[model samples]
Target chain A: MLTSATILSALLGGLLIGSAAGLLLLLSGRIAGVSGMAAAALRIADKGPPWSQAAAFTIGLPIGAAVVLAIVGRPEVTITSSVPLLVAGGLLVGFGTRLGNGCTSGHGVCGLARLSPRSLAATAAFMGAGIATVFVARHILGAG
Target chain B: MRHALPGLVVGTLFGAGLALSGMTNPARVLGFLDIGGRWDPTLAFVLAAALVPSALAYLLVRRMERPVMAEEFCIPQNRTVEARLLAGGALFGIGWGLVGLCPGPALAGLAFGVWQSWAFVAAMVAGMWLQRLYADLRDHRPVHFTG
Candidate 1:
């Protein structure tokens, strides 16, 4: 299932992602944490400085994705989870990202790059929990 | 106008990266998480690749007095390892494992024009709002720390 093209795509995509994060930091010194951006952009958080940047980034996420799809066409995507599970997942992610102060983009990438011990701890915590959840749900419970 | 332009461009690039890497697909994400089963190492590669530019940028930032556009580099200053951080991360991991959709991918999924993506995003937004409300009620200050 894995091909050289796929690996190349992953590498290219990853570099692009890193570039976006680096660009944002270089230009404005903001962490490209999607959850934080969404909270500020949606006006769910108290309005303050640079909220507009968050709004722009949030809007651009979908627009940028659409642009890529237009150029490259859609890839194989199968959402195995039901609607209820997605909702549950969404709620957990939303609350958790805020409570922890970052998501994959924040703690997993930028934080680690910056050599923040907090990011390391947070990333490890989430990865461990994620792996455990999958083990339990798929192996023990026999549920997908 | 100046404030928004960089964010928009960078965001577009970010989304394109996610799409190109196939990270937007929940199934692929699940494949990565399900190491107990048929594992896919693509995400590991993505992570390693992503760290390259990011690490260099951070290193570069150290030499520069300030960001090009911003007056100063704004980042989290707190280093205290709070229990809330671990608990919250764990909770987020559970959600991510369940659906293999984090905030970024879910938001980017909007471009897929899939109902599931929309649903996940809506719920995620609501969840964020709920957390904001909870924090507001708990303390007068807003939660903006990223440490």
Candidate 2:
């Protein structure tokens, strides 16, 4: 059920991310593409502000979520699967973001809007893989 | 204000829609994905609602001269379906299925301060780092996908 709190929170949350991405461009001349930022940070030439922006942007995510929880209370998180599986899943996602050249945000939102062919393929890949994994996890592994 | 500003505006509106539709709530998303343990079908409506805005945006953009940012209009190009592509897609899918979150909604969910989301984002960054390294080793130039 969609509550008023949920609606308000989402609106505010979206504003923050959009604002940050906008401010980055309006001020510094950069796209808030997470994969691009991560790539820049890992580069040997990376120094000063790029690293900071990447760190700050990455850090802001959790802080923002925390702020919401403080206001609306925590949601119950249940994981029936083992920790190893979860960690493995995380590692795979890391690799995928790299291979895909972007994650959901970079491709689904940023790339797609740009109408970048790469983003389209990447987004399709994102959805296709997600659907396949769900099918396998539910029917074969019985993980869900 | 011409380039990313509009994108930012569109993104914020999209984010708000997700939140209002209850798609941004991790628990609701988890329930939707669960399939067996109290399956929630509310996400269907969210998806349907989103189609309107998505279609409108596409129509608007199609009529525009190049986007306000770049030298030319952005268009996807890479079409070769290779091994790396398949592998990467599979991995991303597995993570999404397990966690019930993706980067966009995950970032939005960040407003809630979930430790798991932190972990997920951290892992996402690490993955990006590894990929950059691999790309650098494989090619002298940075991987620039035109498509």
lDDT of 2 by residue, A106-133 (tens): 5654555455666677767766676666
Candidate 1, residue B127: how far the Cα is off, in Å: 0.9
DockQ of each: 0.64, 0.23
Query: Tens digit of lDDT per residue, candidate 1, span A51-76?
Result: 77998998888888888899999966
TM-score for the first chain in candidate 2 comes to: 0.75
How close is every model to the real structure, measured as TM-score? 0.95, 0.63
Tens-digit lDDT track for model 1 on B1-147? 767998899889998888888889988888899999989888888888898999899999989998998888887777877899998899899999999998888888888888999888888887887788788778977654421
lDDT of 2 by residue, B1-147 (tens): 344334434344434434444555545665566664566665544543333333344455556664445444333345565667656766776787776766556655556555665576666656656665677778887754321
Model 1 chain A poorest ten-residue lDDT run: A42-51
Instruction: Pick out the ten consecutive residues of candidate 2 chain A with the lowest summed lDDT.
Output: A41-50
Which sections of candidate 1 miss by over 4 Å? A47-49, B140-147
Q: What share of the true interface contacts does each candidate keep?
A: 0.76, 0.24
On DockQ, the leading prediction is: 1
